[model samples]
Target: MSNTPSQSQLHNLAQDIKQWGAELGFDSIGICGVDLRAHEPLLQSWLDAGFHGQMEYMARHGLMRARPGELLPGTLRVISARINYMPEDARCATTLEDPTLGYISRYALGRDYHKVVRKKLKLLAERLQQALPELKLNYRPFVDSAPILERPLAEQAGLGWIGKHTLLLNQQQGSLFFIGELLIDLPLPMDAPANPECGKCTACIKACPTGAIVAPYQLDARRCISYLTIEHAGPIPPELRSAIGNRIYGCDDCQLICPWNRYAPVTQESDFSPRQQLLQPELLELFSWSESEFLKVTEGSPIRRIGFERWQRNLAVALGNAPYQPRIIEALEQRQAVSSELVKEHVDWALEQQKLKKDQEQVENRQKARLIRWIKKALPFHA
Candidate 1:
């Protein structure tokens, strides 16, 4: 326990690490050497094209996002782990099919994964240090907190291939999971990256509501609903509002359409379970939440970080996209009176949208009535 371990010992330690990770609730774990030079250009090109949108942190780090060694000096390997997060009560289809219901992404339905994943990885690191006292066990745990390219790291660690949607996809478990990494100073047995299997299928790209997946393995975060709803702090772009549908938080349309996700397993961790308040919530019900109520309802959930203003802003867009309902219009008008300037702008847009929907419906109804009368007159009596 006191002496530096040999290669055989390191391999044994790697096995123990995966065992510990599984015990700590990670669905799967893999280890790989940290050499991301191949992934740098792709990351650079995405940044150069401004595909990351308002997530300035992604560019601020420069290439440090690709180089794991830069984040933790002496980091020789990335211990990648994925925790299944598809909650048992996930009603993705039901929520997505109804425009009247505000669909929060399934991942955000549970407690904030940043806290849960980071805590678990930290514990796993402590166990590694305790088990190998002589091996300078310098390590850092990262949930989505670091600038690291976690998906590629996970892919390199034999976790899964990055699907067209840009999410890591396991052949067995699909993409309904959270990825975390521990940068460690160990020569652990390396795991080979999973083979790409998407072959000719463009389901994710075709299914994107906003065409965010500009190409295979490429994404434009500017058009991504997840980025629009969570990362961007300003007004939601008017062009993309209706396409946003009733997705008030994040969009799962890409994943929902991916073929692999049909086999995704429900998470075992109860922390990843949905809160009754988050799932299948009505657009009007959420639009009416006072800032205090928003905070209280979203406490301990990932949705809280977006704050009440974005919460209202997103809900306003969804309300506008909903069927022409009088209550939705009234709620938008009432909130406009007291909302922040930002929220008021979205409310105005929503009000305009509701009016348009109403106008269109009235015209269509009149046309239908006329068509029915003409059909009756032209058909029955003499013919």
Candidate 2:
């Protein structure tokens, strides 16, 4: 039922795919050949170094994550796509600076992108088949769900360069987007990789609270705040708690400090707009949420993946780092009995931090009293 096409016809079909992708709401799309053998060793090295942290899934997938053809049989080309997720109403910097407000990553402020991007990718694949029915096209869409090295695939497809912080960065769009891909049978003409433009920039590295970016293009997820808040289910490590600040979901200091993001546009997709409760939410308010409240608010959002226990654990740490307030102490102490052991430990830690703050304030007051007494005694004759 299929006929051979000349090189020109195949090239034209490739062009049509991009148009269809745009119409279906993708910000950009590009195609590339399936050889990703080069990134396999880099992945293995990260695993060997145990940089993936508690994410056993990364170790389980291994190098198949880099091999698109092996994962999706008969795949000759990969159509990589990017969708901006920066919500317009998100005050990323404003929220980060306020110790009382939780700074959820801008990407997670909106609806979960896995569902959004995957649906669009599937539609793109369907349209490609409809347009070129004679070829009996077959394809599979992926949105960070499968064992796929999405960043590398996007880079090879000319979507963007992998930045020093280990994220795909478009020269024009910065690094505030989600990437999805469609592996297909068509031998599409390939696009060249984008030019790396992060010249001498160490902002992302220096901005990381936990120093997770050990080197350019290297990320130790173990120390990454985003990973601790979202991926790791057990208690967050004690050493990193204070550095976490008000980030209850994911951290965005790296992206916020990057100068290239100066022109990062607000996402055109309405689905990415921030939800009411998530926008600059107060730490105490979020902490007060019952499991039902948490589930209802984060229903279609990515934060629900962490569940209530980890959510409480993250909030407890944030409260510990918050400018010491009596109410924050009361709130943290009241939850100990009602919480899981993981949450209780973090709650106890927050109480200790509050107690230390009380001690520090007392010492400062005593010193101030002595200074005042000395000043009065010395200047008594003048007065």
Candidate 3:
């Protein structure tokens, strides 16, 4: 082992790291010592509750997730970094209110964050390695790939506190950010934890259409729109479909309703800006895309990971909630005639919804026309 760097040198290094992180597009950087044992029981209990749904990997990771040293054989501190993902021009309120528009999670509307964050982290690690040849750094960068409890580590590093929605929230940046970590075998100065600021605020919990929050700071991933649209592989549960609205990718209801989000900084990174037709796409318009078109449009996007089948599946559910129209009926039938069994099932369900809606609209239009005729008859001159 090499001699420990002096306190002043370590402090200077921390400052340099922060500067480098900002230069590399990261909004904030903090160091956290490796001691997450306290979080193990909570993780285990959450898994035991089966809140993770079909994501068996969460349970399989066991205590390794909470113990970073064991997962990476790291000897010292972790460097946690965050990048704000909320697009500068994103219309959060309008998208939330207009259920007909597909509400993609803001984080996913742009380029895939995993690749972008990892690339920046790798560059940061390289810079550190070059700065001290004798430092003997054993560093590994991770985005959302590993079992690491990123939010808690970010909190311990003083990036932000874990909010009631279980997302890391900064006083200045709110919760519209993505977190990445660099586990290194070097001692670094750490920051004080940010104080929790979610007092008396139940907006996120109350706003959740599926009650996925379950309790404050606790999330049942099974009912979460983000989980269902992105992480889930099979057919979504029937009950949560209506609550999902037209979010074909992921949901941002909690963040939209959070009072703290008013302070969330919009990202300046061009890579995080909305691409293709993601920002204001109509449900039927997206449903009209062929599989090839879907692949082409979603190229280099995080949405591609879900594959065309699941993408169609999500859209089918959204179509069911859309106002019934002839085009919607045609779209469902077109997919049903040649789609996979899984996609076919969802299309069939959407067709049933469309039929019901058509019947209702017919009755409403007939009543409306009758009222118009009655008014005309009452005013003989207008007739």
Q: lDDT: which candidate is best?
A: 1
Task: For candidate 3, write residues 1-383 as lDDT tens digits.
Answer: 48668899999999999999999999999998989988989998998899999888888887789989976785588999999998888987787677677878889899999999999999999999888988678888999999889999999999989999999988888899999999998888888878898998999999898899999989999999989988898888888888888888888889888888889988978899998599888888888888899999988889999998989999998888887779889888888888998888888888998899999999999999999999899987887
Clashing pairs in 3: none
* TM-score of each model, in listed order: 0.96, 0.96, 0.96
lDDT of 1 by residue, 1-383 (tens): 23657889988999999999999999999998888899889889889999989889989997998899999998889999999998888988899899999999999998999999999999999999889766667899999998899999999999999988889999999998999999987778898889988889999999999999999988999999999999999998899998999999999999989999999999999998899988989888888778899999889999999999899999999988889998988888898889999989999999999999999999999999998888889986743
Task: Give stretches of model 2 more than 4 Å off.
Answer: 1-4, 373-383
How well does candidate 3 match the true structure in TM-score terms?
Answer: 0.96
After superposing candidate 1 on the true structure, give the runs of residues whose Cα lies further than 4 Å from its correct spot: 371-383
Q: How accurate is candidate 3 locally (lDDT)?
A: 0.89
lDDT accuracy of residue 279 in candidate 1: 90
| Candidate rank order under lDDT | 1, 2, 3
TM-score of 2: 0.96
Tens digits of per-residue lDDT for model 2, 246-360: 8998888888888878878888998898998999899999999999999999999999999999999999999999987999999987898899999999999999998899889
Candidate 2, position 79, lDDT: 95
